[model samples]
Target: LAKTTQPISMDSYEGQEVNITCSHNNIATNDYITWYQQFPSQGPRFIIQGYKTKVTNEVASLFIPADRKSSTLSLPRVSLSDTAVYYCLVGERGQGGYNKLIFGAGTRLAVHP
Candidate 1:
């Protein structure tokens, strides 16, 4: 199984674009990489999921390499309100939904003035 690692904290000014990268060196072949963004008091929102190549939606974009060992999340024109924790989870989507999900310390993103 692949383990993910990301920045413990990051700071950015409002209106700046931010990119966070996660490394999963041992990612499995059937695993799906998912990215979630969490607010201070709210549950995480699904930002994007990708197996390979790139996936883009209204919230963010996920870029996965062919090796499937890492991914990047791009947040465009972020604001102070966007400050939150970002998690990169790599697991079996179908089997893990019913099981308890493990979380990392999480990357705390702080948007500044």
Candidate 2:
């Protein structure tokens, strides 16, 4: 498994965009970097993923440098509803396809009025 480091908290007001970056210095060969978003009292939901380069979806864009050591998640036109803790996880976590070794301590995101 690869260890990850991310901000403990972030502050954002309404109508602004937020981008969070996570680093995994010792990322494994078979592992991939994935990002998740969580609202208060709710489980984290998948946002985007990438092994290298750029990946975009309805919610956010994932930018991974060629080094494959770190990645950034970009959320566009963020709203109060979008203000929430974001997490970056490496390794299978079972890939939602197998048994998972659960690890939790998700960052807290505060959305100011």
Candidate 3:
């Protein structure tokens, strides 16, 4: 599993674009990058996933460099409701052919009025 590091917290005003970056120094070739968002008292919700290059959906966009050692989650025009902890994860196969995703402490985004 690759170790990921992200900012502990970030501040954004409403209607502003916010970007959170994560670094994984030991990423592997077969690993897929995934991002999740979790609100208070709720489970983490899938935001985006990518292998390389950029991927975008209605909710957010994910960018992965060619080296696969880093990724960024970009949220456009965030609102106060979008405030949450964003997780960056890497998926790999564990022992016994089981797939596993490892998560670290996520970056907390505070969307202000």
Candidates' TM-scores?
Answer: 0.91, 0.85, 0.93
Q: How far is 71's C-alpha from truth in model 3 (Å)?
A: 0.5
RMSD of each: 1.7, 2.4, 1.8
Candidate 3: lDDT over CA atoms? Answer: 0.92
Candidate 1 backbone collisions, by pair: none
* Best first by lDDT, ranked: 3, 1, 2
lDDT of 2 by residue, 45-99 (tens): 8888788899999999999898878888888877778877888888754655873
lDDT of 3 by residue, 1-113 (tens): 88899999999999999999999989888888889999999999999989899999999999998888899999999999999999999876456797677778899999999
Candidate 1 stretches greater than 4 Å from native: 95-100
Q: Could you give candidate 1's per-residue lDDT for residues 1-113 as a string of tens digits?
A: 46899999999998899999999998878788888889988998878889999999998889998898889999999898889999998887777455234567778999999
Using TM-score, rank the candidates from best to worst. 3, 1, 2
Model 2 local distance difference test score: 0.78
lDDT of each prediction vs. the true structure?
Answer: 0.87, 0.78, 0.92
* Runs of candidate 2 exceeding 4 Å displacement: 93-104
RMSD over all Cα atoms, model 1: 1.7
Model 3 TM-score, all chains together = 0.93
